[model samples]
Target: MRSVFHGWWVVAAAFAVTFVGFGAAYTFSALFAPLQLEFAASRASVSAVFSIAGFLYFALGVVSGPLSDRWGARRLIVGGMIVLAAGLALAAAARSLTQVYVAYGLGVGLGVGLAYAPALGAVQRWFVARRGLASGLAVSGIGVGTLVLPPLAAALAQSVGWRGAYLVLAVLALVVGGGMALLVESDPARRGLTPDGAPPPASAPPPRGVALGEAVRTRRFAGLYAGCLVCGFGVFTPFAHLVPYALDHGIAPTRAALLLALIGAGSTAGRFLLGGLADRLGRLPALLSMFVGMAAAMGLWAAASDFAALAAFALAYGVFYGGWVALLPAVVADYFGGRAVSSIIGVLYTSVAFGTLVGPIAAGRAYDAAGSYLVPIVLAALANLAAAAIVAVTARAPTSSR
Candidate 1:
């Protein structure tokens, strides 16, 4: 009888953790209108909550990354769950927008940052050959969370109001998240297994690669950093504004929520399909394809007006964006090796953080200032095209030897 590979267990755990964490973090968009109405805040002001939380998420991941390599992800993830729950609990009970900022923005954002990179990095350690597939499966939880949670959140909000919906998420974070933590091990070596469930031949280099500090000195790192920054920025604009953009165009609130679900739906498919593609086509080719698709999709996004148009945008955005997320950590492994996967990926993620930081807030401010979403949407389309071009150029650059 063959025992199941423990690496799969790590993937399963990562899936659960990302589902709850990203689902909760992204719930802000679903909750956005309600929060805005309740607080009597402007769109930019309301968006500040998610923006602040997103910044903290990226910044904290920088620290959590190296720590994941040393300490394992179990403790860090468990701690993240506790923080996430507390943030939700605090946000649920809050009487003022300021309190919501501290609870949801600072608390939840910080917790998610701590959990995300570490969880993904741990998976990188588990599989070498199937790296793309494993990451895609684990991160599909993020897309599913986005897809399922918003509609569910809308339903919950209808039944119990937004507060109850948050309470539900908080409880889920505590229980499901805690159980998942027990299954996480930073390295399969702790269980005496090599990557991809077999020993490498003596001639193969060890999966562990150069230290992050040294990896940063290479041309490859700079290209990856700059490209990811643009990718992150272009990707986040819609997540922050899509719901409101829909509502502003006279879509019902319930229908507005569906746009996010559509994106999530696209993301789920993209994660698995593109992940498989990366493995088969080579990471660079797969990445190039997704970036090109996203560039075209963002053009679709800018022109979206009707439900049909918006739905098209969601599906297109989801597929390309989700694939890009799944491919990245594996790409890092292709470059830097597995030993410091989290640390290296963490730094790259800060570019993602930079995207989340400026994209959402800037889009929000642009909408507020211009009294229209058209500017931001068009800008996002251009940014995506730029990112695709940059990544293509980087693809041609020489690989790092470090």
Candidate 2:
């Protein structure tokens, strides 16, 4: 069997499953209203579920990365699919708010933690030269999921009840995600090719491994970690709140849903387009540009009152956000080398998990206290500005050569 051919196919397949799984998670903003109405829950409380899930996913990144290094990405991802399906099924049957929290927040979160970051690490192992684009393409699954799933869930919730809708999603995730996980192999070297698709040097020995603790102590690892933290704080707030805020502004619910989808659609375009660019422009420049675009998008979102403006913001933001997702990990690999990319990237993602955990709660509280979404929007815009600065400072790191 040709490992390289099968290897790329596995990477692409993993990307597709992850895109849907993460996208379903991103679509929570669209579900926020219905959930609130159904449970009569406060936005703060409901938003906490996402935070909890994100925290688990990120915190576990610390462990999952090391574990994948010891075990493999295939087991983690497959186990995650099973757990994810089970979590959703349990969530669909949840009667109280606490049950939802346990099922979706903790249970589904466990599945997410297992699957998402490991896939990135796995893809990194397969391609060295194209790692940035490969990672982006893999992560961009969230964008594709965001674009498709939320509306489908929303429409399903409208007719079938939110519980039933969740049940459907649970089944869909299980079959597709499980099948893909079964197909995923951990590395190309297992089949005898070197990283970047070139033939291995005749003298090269088999790949050596790095310890997780050693990986984090390095300066490059610390810089990437900080940059991802700032990026998470800014990136999640918009996706989490945009739909509710749009409805508050008197936009029809369906249209607001469409706007959210547009953001995902924009993200999809950005990932594919920018993945290639990161292959050429260097990861730092590509990432810095994405943060700048995110800052601008937040500013535009702050001022937006109509569909046209929101649409423009989504398209523009999606492109850069998509690009950033694609390139940042590859940048780290360039500095640290791919030998322990997953563990290194996993430590960096701990910061990202922190940002995602905090972003929505802070934004939700800001809206509740201020009685408008403006404060949160402005704050998010400023957060993006800060992210840009972090990326700028860190851009001093090596772009391609390790």
Candidate 3:
């Protein structure tokens, strides 16, 4: 009888790590209103808390990715979970919004930054043929976390208050996130197997691909980076403000929180279904579709006035967003190969870091100035469309030599 492949175990572990890290990070939406009420801060100032955290988590990947390449993913992931827990605990004790920015922003941001790229890099090394499916499955944790955590945070906030809610989440990060981090391994070669679990040929060479410096110099890389950076300008707006948007339309708090859940649900399905579909449909074209789909969904959001329309927008947006997230690492792996993948991915994500930092805060400021989200939503849609054009042009370029 054949033993089950260990690569799948890595996928499961990656799933849990992402679930805890992103779930905790995303719970900011649930905490948003309370923090505003507690701090007497402006919308832009409050949103900056998440923006700072988002920027750190994504931007820090540049350092963490190279470190993970040198130190192994497990160590980085475990350390990250600890840092995340500590950040949350500190945020629980914060007396002012500035403290929250330091504690939660740095803590959650640094924590996720350390773990995310390494986990993704580890998963990329474990498979070749099913890279898209595996990548999709691994990142679907973000969707699931988004689906489950915000509502849980909202409920806990109602019962125990936001500080107590942060405390509980901190404990969860230490126990669950740290525990799973143990199972991640950077390379299948250590276990005498090749990618996709085939026994290594005795003469087989180590995984081969472009180094980070060389990879970064390619036109393909430039297009991918530019596209992601442009999209970043609008990509994270909903994650930070969707609940507030729903509430502004007179939706109940619980129901409003569930809107994020709807995105998660749609995202989960997209990662699972569209990921497999991309393997058959061609990954680059599928990636292009995601940008187009997100642009269309953002249009729906701009026009939505009621619960039904908002829910539709959430589900639609979630599907493409989920697919976009799932496909990126796989596409990176496909274009560049496994060597220096973590480092390359980390660098690529800096685009997202800048966008994450600016997008939510800009949306908040726009809302504050105009008393509505219309301008930002429309801009976000346009940004996605621009991203689609970039991706389309890049797809026509030759793939990088493996």
Query: What lDDT score belongs to each candidate, Candidate 1 first?
Result: 0.85, 0.77, 0.92
Number of the top TM-score candidate: 3
TM-score sort, best first: 3, 1, 2
Residue ranges of candidate 1 with Cα displaced over 4 Å: 199-207, 396-402
**Clash count for each candidate, listed in order shown:** 0, 4, 0
Q: Candidate 2 regions off by >4 Å?
A: 1-4, 206-211, 397-402
CA RMSD (A), model 2: 2.5
Residue 84, model 1, lDDT: 91
Across residues 253-317, which tens digit of lDDT does each residue of candidate 3 receive? 99998898899889989999998899988998999999999999999999998999999999999
Q: Candidate 1's error at 208, in angstroms?
A: 2.5
Instruction: Put down candidate 1 lDDT per residue, 222-255, tens digits, no spaces.
Output: 7778877887765777777889988988999899
